[model samples]
Target chain A: MLDVKAEAAEHSGAGAPGEEAPPLVVEGLGHAFGERQALRNVSFRLNRGDRTMLLGLNGAGKTTLFSLITRLYNHRSGSIRIFGFEIKDKPSEALARLGVVFQLATLDLELSVAQNLLYHAALHGLPRREAAVRLKREIERVGLTDRLREHARTLSGGQRRRVEIARALVHQPKLLLLDEPTVGLDVASRQFLLDHVRMLCNEGGIAALWATHLIDEVDSGARVIVLHHGQILAEGPVPEVIRRANASSMREAFDKLTGERSE
Target chain B: MRPIHYARCLRGIIWREALRFINQRGRFLAALVRPLVWLLIFATGFRFVLGVSIIPPYQTYIPYQVYIAPGLIGMILMFQGMQSSLSMVWDRETGSMRTLLVSPLPRWYLLTSKLIAAVIVSVLQAYVFLFIAYFWGVHPPRLGYLTVLPALILAGMMLSGLGLFLSSVIRQLENFAGVMNFVIFPMFFASSALYPLWTVKQANLKLYYICMANPFTHAVELIRFALYEKFNLEAFAVVGGSLVIFMTLAILGYDPGRGLIARRAGTE
Candidate 1:
């Protein structure tokens, strides 16, 4: 499965080979605001076709780390690389392979769904004809094919999020970074989103880093990185992390790890 | 990125701006009404009070309405520029600006595209105002209209660049009202838009110098001369120089590593 999608990505010119570097790499990433350190010594690597859950409580620097990775905020003390291209040095090459669904909904409410998606596709330099085809395919994937002409404001919250996911995929990015993508979502909507993204990673060979504070979202088969107070408390396969914390489930493991640090 | 990519991105940004402008019926009305009020009522009321000598652009004595038509056009461009700035701030607050920022293109190219989009909208608005003014007996030479296009574009670029610079520094949508009072109003009132420089010179030498120093004044002068099929070298130089300066500063202000975004990153 991985090889099939990897070959597709290579042919599509989405993945640039750089000594076969991983999809994403963060090394000694540190960021501070005046006197308050928001993120400290954050280091991780996400390989192709990997699904990693970045689990943390509120104020654990999840958003800050995402911001640096997205290049929304500059990282002064560390480095971030995408496909072996450093973010600061070769942002165009680095960001070309990245797709992001931010926590906040960024759609222009006045524009139709298709318009919003096409605008994003153009930003990624896709030709108009190709963008239109991808727009149809991606929106169909999210089950919004019938709502293409509807204004974004007319869509419900769940529908809006699905469109955002479709927009992120229109460029055929190799790595998808979703920051609390399921926040404020209903149970059904959340499950649909979680499943859709995981399926994309598994079948398309697109590396994904899903950040969330919700424990139920992390499956046992997934790798987990537990962050607490701007530091990583544990990182491994979900079951291994649970075993290391001496807890039976992810919830207990997370509580135990964060609880010990708070004391 | 290829040149084709840049061209497509520019087309997309401008198309988006045009679509937004078309959708906001109230915004279109407001842009026209503000300038029309000055032409129909304000200029009419002051027609006799503000007597005009035969200026270089004016071959003979003209009514205040005709004299101020270009000023009203300048007003449209300035207000549209400020409106673009307000929308930028709103986009930032709503997180749509992040969508643009995270694109694979260079930051400077993205910002320049945005500025060009804004200038295109402002110029369209200016032409609409000029068309209305034509029916109001504010006719310039037929060739004047064609000549004014370049001036309107240059002046629009300068004003929009100013707005773009202001948008980068203004942190919040709420703070934009302060900019209206502190920047827009002052710029409009202290320029040659409403009155001639000589009139202000007679009133106060210091005020005249202030007007001379004001970039808005030069923008108004540029538009005034272009409306008469002439060019003011000084005004052209000043407006062009201001466009370069403002555009450079606006680009720097949006730079992720060394700009205002870096300073505010911790808070976000």
Candidate 2:
């Protein structure tokens, strides 16, 4: 059982109808390597109708947590339930419900857009017609309809990121896990990606766990899971956590929570 | 799950790897060239001095080229396994491995899909080598040709498993060349590829047992036995036994916490 009392207080004001099953959930999760305690009894939840951005410093176990949730690597102790299924015992079924855009460019550079989509679709076991229909929508949504014939490697950084997002949605997964999706994008592209994510949560009710370290990317209203030393230092709406830390902004809250200001 | 989907996934993985190789035309040529040299040049030169024997599957005495067809096929599986696996290591270094590792599919299935694809491509390439041998006057099994399917699959599984194991542990392609030299060549030479195991006893008995210990020898033996339209029980055991060990290590090598993926070790 996770102590969500503080979290509930912060998020209780959001009138999002009911508290639907969070798209992603981590409970009492912990991990370590040799002498390094990577994650310590971490626990949190994110709803599908809500946008939750994971905030953490470098080596604060941000990627490690994402790796565990995406089932990229193993967690030492704890349970990670995505859409109500544990990753360890029911990986295939549970994982099938997940769409992930890793921090690195996972696209095969030489493959054409259509070819890449088909490959991913087949791999995810999506029906041909349904995959095609969704593929069209996703491509146009990302404004990449014209570049569908181009190779992934030839596209600009922003275009490649867009393609990665489109590729992740080809299966219409209930949960989307993005690891710092807009890291290197220019101003326009970053805004474009953020806007697309907002649409995903608002229109499709698709839950997303958007991992990032930037405060600007964390919208004023979205839930924030602040990670410090591989542990959850704070959670819930961005504004409340800032108020709790008695800080002026989310960055100030983060610095105080992680002991940076104390130092 | 419809079996067709699994079939489709298998095809997609296979197609990607194959197409990638096709895009790298130079690699394809080199893949073909390596075997051609072993068959036309090395085997041909040794054919006279190979000391012909009534090796089973060979109903009557035959030329060394005829005897080594299956071995040549074995070579294809082994090299292709290494080549794809080398790419896997490179993919990890370049950060693409993380992309596939995160796919919702079971890690084993994702890996099996890759191994299966590599096997198919290697099998097709093996057939091309077989056709060339046929034209070169090398006598191959007539009805025994059909058995090549299982033989090739078994061979592919074995080599791919080996390559997977190699990829998990070996960090860089630069270190891989040494691994190939030390592990691959000996496995190929000591096996019943160029010479029969029993014959090896006449020249060197200790060396014969070492070859017998190699799983690759069994892979070669399995293909070699199938080549003659005769079932060799020992070949079956060798191939099966190697598969067991290779798959076990392959799985362990790729294991998240203890294996290469987590440890970031070059080769396991």
Model number with the top TM-score: 1
Summarize candidate 1's per-residue lDDT along A157-248 as a digit string, tens digits.
Answer: 88999999999999988889999998988999999998998888887878899999888899987889998889988988899999999998
Q: Compare the candidates by lDDT and give the number of the best one.
A: 1
Query: For model 1, what is the error of residue A127's alpha carbon versus the real structure, in angstroms, after optimal superposition?
Result: 0.6
Candidate 1: regions farther than 4 A off: A1-19, A260-263, B92-94, B172-175
The TM-scores of chain A alone, one per candidate, are 0.92, 0.89
Superposition error at A9 for model 2 (Å): 16
Candidate 2: stretches off by over 4 Å: A1-20, A261-263, B1-8, B15-26, B47-49, B59-63, B93-105, B169-175, B252-268
The per-model lDDT (C-alpha) reads 0.86, 0.77
Fnat for candidate 1 (0 to 1) = 0.62
Q: How far off is residue A176 in model 2, in Å?
A: 1.5
For all predicted structures, in order, the TM-scores are 0.94, 0.87
Tens-place lDDT per residue, model 2, B67-124, is 7878888888898887776676576433556655655565677788888877777887
